[model samples]
Target: MLFLTRDLFSKKLTILFLIILGTYGCKTKTSSEQTAEQAPALVKSPEFNADSAYQFVQKQVDFGPRVPNTAPHKACGNYLVSTLKKYGFSVVEQTFKDTTFDGTIINGRNIIGSFNTANAKRILLTSHWDSRPFSDQDSLVKNKPVMGANDGASGVGILLEIARVLSLQATKPDIGVDIIFFDVEDWGATEQDTSMLHSGFCLGSQYWAANKHIPNYTAYFGVLLDMVGAKGATFLKEGYSMQMAEDVVREVWTTASRIGYNNYFIDERGGSITDDHVPVNTVAHIPMIDIIHTKNSVVRTFFDQWHTADDTMEHIDPKTLKAVGQTLVQVLYQESANLAL
Candidate 1:
């Protein structure tokens, strides 16, 4: 995913999304129409373990930064595949090569694990697992690797914990759930605005969306998680998601509120973040929303320790993980129950 301060014009998209959504008033959605992605969900939601999620985050951090082509990256990727398979998921490793913004031909992998694959009603959950090679945001050692405790690992951790929880359940859900860990998402050149070239960042998502694991693949909707494991992380409804999947955004935010996570899932509008979800919605034509954190205060222009060396596990908060994890489980369980009905 690309990162920039509003001041960086030459290298940023200059997302004036506030002007697009913050100042504007939204029309009320009809209560009669149930959200297609959520109508089938059950009232009883699944449990999400914050301790397990935190351990998953720590496990990834123990491997050091998962920079592509490195030993840690390869080992971590293999670990993810093996772990998902252990959880009884049908795992597929989609590998591809792409040229980065700095003209480096890099290998990328999109690891997809499918549950209840035959179910027609499916929900896609995704997070980029690769850490940035250079923490350009760091004042010192700007070229060193980023820890990515929240930026990459946190989202994946929540999903992995979700997978673990599903596997342990006595009964499986009627609806399908697919979790994808995308690579090469944080390797874009900070000095270049590669968005103009249509190949800025998120190479794995760009590849998977165009050439999906399954031919003619489609999900009811997708939710991409990023920077979801920090203290006081606020998830504003992102602009691009509203444009592509307004119903999905509403469904997720409403579910969060219903489940007592209203504090984390704020109703305010967030900037148009260009993340993995963009490719899923655009290239694959799947309505997807990004549950990502943007600058929620004047003190910090980004999430806690974003793209910096400080994005370590110490800054991670279990409560934040619980909020995101529990909310997602609620949505899925609701879907599962609704489908059975």
Candidate 2:
């Protein structure tokens, strides 16, 4: 009877141990699930369609050189406005006038489009739409206008593609997006011209900075794209961008590195350029960065075909466009994820 009692006690102890172990395992699983639920999931953005972006670029080129005060320029501006409206954005055509370095009165139109207008948290994307009035950098066609396939149209094409993709989504980003196509960006004075006004370049940006489309309009940050579709392009960290918005530059560059575009976005420092971001940063009080392709070896700190008649589809690479556009989309979605957190 004593031996039977001993065996019975041992069995009871074994049963208790098994039950405790099972309860512990269940608690651990529940804890893990709770932790996962607390963490925000990665938001996946839409795939950037390089082919569509390329087609957009081609459409602008088909309008011929978009020099200010020209027929092609006006027609292209109208198309841009209509396209933004078609993509479900509230469009604003900010019309203004500015005098060029040569004292020529030019009609400038800063096309602004807004997505998710009610959201106070906003991101701004910008590009110059006007082509250079003359190909001063081309030895063969110094007097002819630049086609601006890469410099002017590439950035617009990418942004337009982004707009289209966002419009198709049932649930949009957590933040608002604003696209501004600045006019009269390439009508500055030539390098050899001595009668240059200090405010000769970036006239459209300057005007918009002073008189914004919306009163007291502000964004978390702004990014300006220039010459981003060149083949074998290398985008060094620009100087003015680093000085004005180092955190944004670091985040953007880190994003590029995280997504296999580090080859295009180099880690080196580039010279400061007097681009549209300057006025946006200083006058408008918005921290803006320039994602411009710069090479010290090239004249005017730009690509080989900059401000030249050769600035055409021949030099614009679809791979380069994909790299930039994909990186931007990833950044936007990632930002949305952060907002969720």
Candidate 3:
């Protein structure tokens, strides 16, 4: 997740009356009538295993800091590819050399796994796999590498658990699902570095958005998970998500609310962030929304441990992972049923 250094400033709220209208614009049918017409067989989403997700997070952290140009990074990349293949997914790795903010070029890889590859309707779920290079936000050790347990590994861990369930299913969903682990997303310069480089952060996403793995890949929508494992983490509607993909945001948030995760998925608007979803929305033209933790009451940006060395396994909460993972499974299962017709 990107940090917002400036003070909290509000932008003019874009009235999303159209979305509200469309959402409520059912053909003038009464509530009971609509319920009768729409209520049908509901697919039960499989339970998401929090223990397995936590183990995945721990496995990544055990690799030490997954910073680029490091042995841990390379090993973790290989492990991720092999793990997805073992889960019965069709895996593809996109490797490239990315130039960082400090003029250092490092090898990066974007690992993708597809389920039900023959389906035309698709949903893209993504998270960054690389840990930050420096603990710039740490008060005591400001220059050390971070473990990125919550920031990077947590999201991928949840997705990996989802992949495991998808692999074991007897009847696969009709819609295709792609899980993308983007690299070089955490190599951005510190806030102290005042360089004018706009695309320094999220290098892997920028590359993948421009040169997609498939020739002309597209999805119905995309959901990006970031900083999701912290305890008491609240996910507000990010500004960029509200601007770019309001419908997707509503769908995910509404699902979260329905699943009793309303406390974690708040309804307030949050500051605009420059994370991996930016390139996917702008370059790829895929409506993508970021479900990220925000520090609203006290700190105005991300969680307190963000960018800090303390962002380790101790900061990750299994409850939070289960909440997010369960909600995502529900969303996918419901979307699959809708797309089947």
Candidate 4:
């Protein structure tokens, strides 16, 4: 009877050990599974359609040089307003007149659009729409107006496509977004013409900065796109942008690098430009940066076709457009992930 009791005790002890072991194994497996479930998923930005952007540019170029106060300019302005509305944005047409460098009064319109109206934290994007009146830099055809396919229309086209993608997204970004197509930016006085009023450039932005679409409007940051569609374009950081909004510029350049666009967005300092972002930064008090394609050195010639009649569709590369557009989309959408819940 003593021997039988010993065997029974041994069986009981073995069963208890097995139960404890099973419980521990199950707990370890559960802990690993829980950890995986808690891991954060990577954020995904919407795809930017380079073809659509290219087509939008073509449409604007088809309207001829959009010089302010001309028939083509008026028609293009109307189209921009309509397109923004169609993309589910609250469009605002800011109309104002400003004197050009040559002392000519020109009618200008700034087309502004907004997305995610409920969100108070906003980001501003901008580009010029009006073409230069004369291709003064062109050795041949100095009397003709600039086509502005890359200088003006390219930025607008990319923004329009971005707006379209935003509208079609399944999940809207948590931050408010605004796009402004500022006119009269290219009407600045030439360097040689010292007698002309140099401040006459970027008139549309100057007007909007003083009289914003919303009273006392503000954005967390603003990005200005200029000369972004040139073939083999290299977008070095502008000097003013780096000085005023270094963090923003770093964020953009890093994002571009992350997305295999390090070639287009070089990690170098570029010459400061008096683009529309200048008024937005100084007058509106927003930290604005210009993502412009400028020469590496102080020469800052901008591009081969800059201010020339050769600034046409032939100079635009779909790859260049995609690089800028994709990087922009990634930055904007990733910003959503950074917002407070």
lDDT of each: 0.88, 0.89, 0.89, 0.89
Over 89-187, each residue of candidate 3 has an lDDT whose tens digit, in order, gives 899999999789888988999999998899889999999999998898888998899999999999999999999989888877778999999999988
Q: How high is each candidate's TM-score? A: 0.86, 0.86, 0.87, 0.86
Tell me how far the alpha carbon of residue 331 in candidate 2 is from the true structure, in angstroms, after superposition.
Answer: 1.1
Could you tell me how far off, in angstroms, the CA of residue 264 lies in candidate 3 after the best superposition?
Answer: 1.0
1-341 in candidate 2: lDDT tens per residue? 34558889999999999999999987676643664465455467888999999998999999999999999999999999999999999999999988898889999999999999999989999999999999988889899999999989999998999899899988788999999999999898787454553448889999999999999999989989998898998898899999999978876787787778999988789998889999999999999999999976654678889888899998989999899998888888888778767
For model 2, the superposed segments whose C-alpha errors exceed 4 Å read: 1-42, 192-199, 298-300
lDDT of 1: 0.88
Which residue pairs of candidate 3 clash? none
Q: For model 3, how big is the CA root-mean-square deviation?
A: 11.6
- Tens digit of per-residue lDDT, candidate 1, span 305-336: 88898999998999999999999998888777
- Pairs clashing within candidate 4: none
In model 1, residue pairs whose N, Cα or C atoms come closer than 3 Å (at least 3 residues apart or on different chains), thus clashing, are: 40-338, 41-334, 41-335, 42-334
TM-score of 2: 0.86
